[model samples]
Target: MSRDERGRGTLEAHRFYIGGAWVDPIGTERVTVRNPADGSVIGTAAMGNAEDADRAVAAARAAFDGWSRTGVEERLALLRRMRAAFDEAAPAIAAHLVREVGLTTMVAEGQSAMCRSHFDGIFDLLPSYPFSASDGGMVELAKEPVGVVVAITSWNAPVSQMLCKAVPAIAAGCTVVVKPSEQAPLCGMLLAQAMDKAGIPPGVFNLLNGRGGDCGRRLAEHPDVDMVSMTGSVPGGGAMAAAAAPTIKRVHQELGGKSANVILPDADMAEAVRKSVFGCMMNAGQTCAAPTRLIVPEDRFQEIAALAVAAAEALVVGPPDAPGVTYGPLSNQAQFDRVNAMLERAIAEGLPLLTGGPGRPEHLSTGFYARPTVFGPVPVESFLAQEEVFGPVLSIQTYTDEEDAIRIANATPFGLAAYVQSADPAAARRVAGRLRAGYVTINFPPWTAAAPFGGYRRSGNGKQYGVWGFEEFLETKAIVRA
Candidate 1:
């Protein structure tokens, strides 16, 4: 379809950005970006082959020598400019994310908030890094840049993940090669433009538009790339780390999650159920850190389950750009189908559907839409409860008491994030400490940018954002005097 015919301008398919310029994809084929709202083609974007990934990697290697050696002050100044550029372009970026990814404006705003916050937080922590240190009359240690970095980000919160890796890597004086998810690559291209406007040197921050299997694989496996950081599926993260292993490059991954919300018996059932549904169902539950499983008191099962169902029923799922929209369409068809299958399996397994079950909303039949699903008394071993659905599905399981709640919350193999809602702050803190996860939101506290974010166990390793994030791009060397 032509741009004029569609009324939104012709979307170009197959354009890759390398060394500050947009070029045609090296591959012959292209991928289409579909609006989940109606399953209509929004535009076509580039899908780079393995060969194209190599070319991007070569360009990144060539630029890294100069960019990595540049002084910290120079890099910081450039990032400051980039931050300003982002501020000026905030509205456009936010709008693009909403239209392309089918996220509510509030969620888009959250992505913007994360992007701006990461940019500002990393800069704040840069001055504190131990770039050079001394102990007595001898040199103690020095943290040096690790050269070229390949950062692969997921589509759920495109800008948020990109900034999580890119901002800190830049702050540590490392040149970056970003491979954004094909599902939402336009945002990456726009970010490249912002970097250029910020006066960043060519090749300093290169963006490649391509699929994960081909372009992303090559980038992860390239020998010239010195380090890799990715945020996506656990399998994807493992593959990237394995690809980087032969070259001995540092691999930092933040992957899949099925976080638990442990609602203590002492906690208010109304408040706990409210936050659990909203948190898990936010972004259509596409977030890696979303608390999808709720572990509540078994005795209070009926009470909390009813409240959760009410919350889900109250949610207004519609087009992202629509007024008063609470939830948006799933990112793609695959996610939509997966959610439906899981719901069906839950029903078949005898789990009672507290609120929404499956299928598209009756009103909007075209786009990927799954009713907000909530299940109570679900078996912990069920795929719907164990696996990461990455959809607007919440599984409610009841527990005996605080001890049982923590046990259920800690049952998941993925430990990315956890949540606890309690009337008593001390009790919440005590529970938070015991949960084996990277982050815990007590009473849904404001997500802080300066806080360190990563995962434990199968969730993947290495921190992102703040000082810990910046350090991932640096290699610490110790010197001892005779």
Candidate 2:
């Protein structure tokens, strides 16, 4: 169970970055890191405990005062260096993601690239950002760092998630102690190395490696920690918020999503249906903002469903290294089991399966791979459409008109993101505006990092990415000097 082993698994996984140095865990306990593509144990990584969380938080608290007072220019310069470190580590990050999360190298690299793109995007906001403003020339409204931050990121996009929270927190002059998802710890380790290589001030950036029940819980419940920014399941976010509530600290949760994809009557039917399938299936449908629910015009429901089936059938699911794989297996067995369970219930309920169903893709004899499934004639009120299925499962619902389409799209309680497709620009924007999501897409456009990202209602509170993300780590202050 030694985490010190080398080769494919990063050695630092066995250790932690605390107080600006690499340190071993408080105990010999280790967590297994497995290859989802093959269901093989990659190696064991250090399993942290409450003591480790204590040490990491103490370090962050100790460094916060000085780091917070540092000039903005100094922080930006250090981030530039950190961005360079990320550049040097990008390849390793991408390579490890393939084994850690069962993503094809091409897709993993895209995830890895977010390290740079996110940092770059946030950097653009710093120069023009409004940090201080006068309130009617009577008082000065200044923004300052919120204080010690604990970032608990999900495994889906480990490095990117860390960068989105930690980078912005650091930029806002707040010290951080990050606890990456136990499901994917290597990328977080790699990012810690990047931070160290960039010569970040000790304790300004620390990484704790452990399960949510262990060190993760300690970090959330710690009194000195000013805020907890988490991205994961709704339950996980709720736990973190509850833990922090006693201390009355700020909690930002970027939780679950069962986002909708609305294909309007004016849209190209074939193209829209294809994008819906591909979009929902990407990352094995683990994305919190994925459009898992598809609402289409009822008159052409059968036609669109057939096209969706063709698209789903065309997707090749296999090992991450295998050629021509449209996507890989679920990150772990739990996710695979969860996905199949939901699918089986639908089948039992006599739901129509346009393509794929309850099992692994036929070619995927092994591994935690679920077939890329697409279902049609799904009732908008059914669990298949109502619940958040973090798998490559698409549920299609029919809509009678634009109002019905909008109604169906907003039917879900979760409103993290929604997609609208239409040939008419005005029509697309109109629908996009009506959708209750914080982030909406029109016609499968590229995901821009500069835009604000968060959800409305139960999806989660607060925002991330660009200035919105940076602001979460900051507190507003009013100085009277009139």
Candidate 3:
């Protein structure tokens, strides 16, 4: 582990973690890790290539049979040890997130803490999970490990996402090779350290640091890998699907979303609007399931737009390290540019911009900081409402009635999540049922960490979290007596 002597915090992954150890990269080229807050080089990670991917995949495949046959109690014991290591490194993980992705301290900490939840949540479900049952005759059926699994995660939530795929796959007795986003590879490095410290058998868990198109695609396409689970953009997911197609491996994707948050006229406008803005603007609006589209009653559009503006104003957007800075810069230059272009096009299209547009927050002359933007009552067909901006931008749309509200909410091609707010719980729940989303809620109910989290429609296939996620890495087998 290399530290930024400048005190930016710990994380400079110099090599790949394969076969349960840190090994030197095959290529000398490196991806420079930067602090998004001010664009300073934090550290350098050795860039990986197809050779690196082959090595990691081979390692996983070599150990697959033994790991796949390991007793459930044995795997759980090791996972608990790995979880303990994660707890000790939570602060450092949060620190790395702040510098690597510009997530504010609070958000970064929350993201880091989520890694533990994934472990415990899956642990809670694994014991009770039905791996085998009688076939109601002289036969039996069982769920067995699916062999090698490759987990490719995005930069936004690296650690949690990695373990979200790895923990469950391991629990299901599947060996895994994780190719985390090259943009935020430190988390992968950190996880590798934790795995090594926990004494996880070599090759049961492997980490390769590289771009999605390079080593990521190699692992996805490798004939030996039994499945590939990716958390990223629709386009990225598409590419992965295409790559894994010929291999005929299972692909579980938790892709992009332009989630809708519908606010019924009878709901508390101020509080609901406040929650919508906060949810949208969190992590500088980089979340996949963020409620970027707010559907409100047409009659209350103006009133709610003003409320949204007030909420955006209350959100502090500036240097991530500054105290009280709830909002920070975009994760990288590419995302910063994409969000700015989207904002510019929306402005040029003459949309009614309620607040914020096109550039850094006025206070910060440098950094990738963007203004907390909110576009009101935008047309449901507009890209602002239909596309995933993946930044701290909210597009509010007007709904004529409950039917129109559900229609507007389901208008997007993506359906990762949806939100509904109403004075009556029954009404909210009723509206939520009509929405075409994997996850729906009336008011922001307390999150169930173990709840299955995957989407319908283009949001990608398979469920994640708890038993649902654990099963994704398993295949059913039926054994019969003659």
lDDT string, candidate 2, 1-482, tens digits? 22321227434478899999999889578777788888677766787999999999999999999999998799889899999988877777777788888887778878866677778976787877788999677799999999999999998988888888889999999999999998887768777876899999999999978889878888999999999999999889888888889999999989999998988898998888888898999888888998899898899987888898899988888887778888898998889889999999999998998888888877668889989899988998899998998999999999998999999999988989999999999999999999999999999988778789999988899999877888999999999984
Model 2 regions lying over 4 Å from their true place: 1-12
Expressed as tens digits, the lDDT of each residue in 1-482 for candidate 1 is 23332124445645666777777777876777877887676678767889888877777777788887778688779889999988877777787777678898899888888888887886777766668888878678888888889999998888878878888887777888898988787777767766778877877787878888878888888888889999899988888888788888888989999998888777778877887898999889999999899988888888888898999988889998888988999988777888888888778888887778888877776788778988878777777778998998888888877787788888878999999888888999999999999988888888887688888988999988778888889998889888
Cα displacement (angstroms), candidate 1, residue 120, comes to 0.7
TM-score of every model versus the real structure? 0.96, 0.96, 0.97
lDDT scores for all predictions? Answer: 0.83, 0.87, 0.87
The deviation in Å at residue 394 for candidate 2 is: 0.5
Question: What TM value does model 3 have?
Answer: 0.97
Off by over 4 Å in 3: 4-11
* Superior by TM-score: candidate 2 or candidate 3: 3
Q: What is the alpha-carbon lDDT of model 1 when measured against the actual structure? A: 0.83
lDDT by residue (1-482, candidate 3, tens digit) is 76543335545688888897789988666777788888888777877898999999999999898988888789889889889888876777677778888988888878866777889886787777788999689889999999999999999989889998999999999999998887787767876876788888999999989888888889889999899999999999999999999989999999999898999989999989998899989889999889899999999877998999999988999877679988889989999999999999999998888889999877888888989999976998888888899998999899888999999999989989999989998899889999999988778777677678889888887988877888899999989988
